[model samples]
Target: MPPLHILHIDASARPGRSGVDTRGSHTRRLTHRFADRWQAARPQDTLTYRDVGRQPPSPVSGEWIAAAFTRPERRDEAARAHLAESDVLVDELLRADLIVIGAPMYNFGLPAQLKAWVDNVVRVGVTFGFDRSRPGEPYWPMLPPDKRLVILSSRGDYGYDPGGRLESVNLVERGLTVPMGYLGLTQTHSIAIEYDEFADERLRASISAAEAAVDDLVGKLARDFAEAAKPSLAVA
Candidate 1:
């Protein structure tokens, strides 16, 4: 099978890995471990890392919106400048078969940086297409359906999963998956570490379980991609 290209994005404000740094990010730890496991299992697979936590894309502005709405051919230098970073981001997203995002929940939602990254990538005429002619379905995804998105998150409280205590309020996964799905990345998987504020046995256990989940997810995805790549045999 051909080697897959993975885009790894870290969105935690906290730097370094947990247990390595006294006050490190659990999301970072999970994402780093996932990447390491992927490399160990498939050394030939390529990875592109983007640290939006530290170097975030600029927030969307009026000029940026106007530029994005403008036709590519008609865009002037100023318009291009407004969308240069977004273009690079969209290119990265297009090249990646698997996207891993380490999103530590901030105020029960996404971090400002990750939000900005999402805004930059979900551009008109790039990730999604819009048309007034097709009133029934004017918008369509531009990305292929095969792309997969894995969101590794960390939260201070527990019970964020489906039917959990805080399922409705948990916006990290919903916020990310919705936009990603709109871009044709409907294959979304998420794993999170809870009880961060407590920092007790629950926190430790959550971390361990989340790490194990990451390992399992990586192995499963690797096998799935490999199997899908195998050529089908003709029947006589």
Candidate 2:
């Protein structure tokens, strides 16, 4: 079997330590460890990393939008070049068998950098298309059917269950996952590490717990991969 291509995206601006305007460092740590485990399990697999923090693009502009929406054949040289960058990003996503996104909660939502990445990739009639074919199914997802996604999220406060004081209205996970599901990526999992209540000792414990969870998940994924490689027999 061929190696699985994994696209790893880290959106946290902070390179290390958690502080105001930067809290997703833990998410990056956890995802790096997870990626390590995944590569160890499948040595032939390839991982591509994209850091949106240091290289955020300017907001999409009218010219970019026009270029993006225009048909390839109709686009001029400069317009095609502009759209090509976005096309490359989307193509990378389309080529990957798995996607891993590291996001930290910002103002109870996704960091602006990550949102910009989404805007660049989720083009109309590409990732998704509007179809009035059925009365209810207005939008149809055009993404590949075989891709899986894993999200590593970190929050300052804990809110595992819904409707708690620290329960964030940010809804970044929901926003990403629902769209991924809409895009036909049904195999999605998220691991969150919360640290709002952690002191020195408690913070260490939180990190330990998060590491263990990643280890356990890695083992399960490896086992599943091995099982899937086995040939199935049909009754005569």
Candidate 3:
């Protein structure tokens, strides 16, 4: 079997993006730490990266939608060119077994940049398809069963988890998880760093917790990848 494929995405859009390598960007640091550990543990694994924070894809437009829905063989050269970026994104996603997204909560939602990337990839008859089984409305992910999504999120406040003080206002975390379910991903995981506005002990503690979670997740995933590569044992 081929090496496990991982897709890494960064979505924090700090002013000038100067904070990429600093503690100021909790999400970005978390993702990098995860990647570093994964690489050390499984050097053979493949990793592909897209930095939406620095260069976000254009928003999906009417033309993009039309081009995407057009039959593969029928789309003209112009349409194909128009959807070039989206096509690559969707293809990259299909090729990856594990997707790692680092998203910072902005006004309780995903950055517009990351949302645009999501819009580009979630194409009909591509990433997913119209569900023929149910009437009214039905859409099912076209992806296989083994794909997974892991999100690292940062927030300016705490209490975003279920039953937390700010859960009602929390949108970024839920938004990221729910969309993947729609995309047919069987497993989704999240590591969050909160209390960012405090810039005190709370923020420090949150970052540490998030980093520890990332390391643990990367180790487990590396082990799983190794196990998956080995052939299954024969039945007795």
Superposed on all Cα atoms, the candidates' RMSDs to the truth, in angstroms, are 0.8, 3.2, 2.4
Cα shift from native, residue 64, model 2 (Å):
2.1
Question: What 10-residue stretch in candidate 3 is worst by lDDT?
Answer: 15-24
Candidate achieving the largest TM-score: 1
* Candidates arranged by TM-score, highest first: 1, 3, 2
Per-residue C-alpha lDDT of model 3 across residues 1-236, encoded as one tens digit per residue: 57788999998875322135444577778888888898888788899999998899999988888898889899999999989999899889999999999988999999999999988888888878886787866887788778878989988889897899988988886777777778887688888999888888998788888889899998877777667778988999
Give candidate 3's TM-score. Answer: 0.91
Relative to the unseen true structure, what is the C-alpha lDDT of residue 210 in candidate 2, on a scale of 0 to 100? Answer: 76
Among residues 3 or more apart in sequence or in different chains, the pairs in candidate 2 whose N, CA or C atoms overlap within 3 Å are 108-170, 156-196
Q: Mind giving the per-residue lDDT tens digits that candidate 2 earns over 1-236?
A: 66678898888887754432244388778788889998888889898998886676456778889987887789899887777668877888888888888887887788898888877887777888875686887887888776778888887766643665665574878768877777677787777777655656666677778778888887776676567667899999
Q: Better model by TM-score, 2 or 3?
A: 3
Q: Cα deviation in Å at residue 118, candidate 2?
A: 0.8
Segments in model 2 whose C-alpha atoms lie over 4 Å from true places: 17-24, 132-136, 160-165, 168-170, 196-198, 226-236
Total colliding residue pairs, candidate 2: 2
**TM-score against native, each model:** 0.98, 0.86, 0.91
Displacement of residue 136 (Cα, Å) in model 3 is 8.7
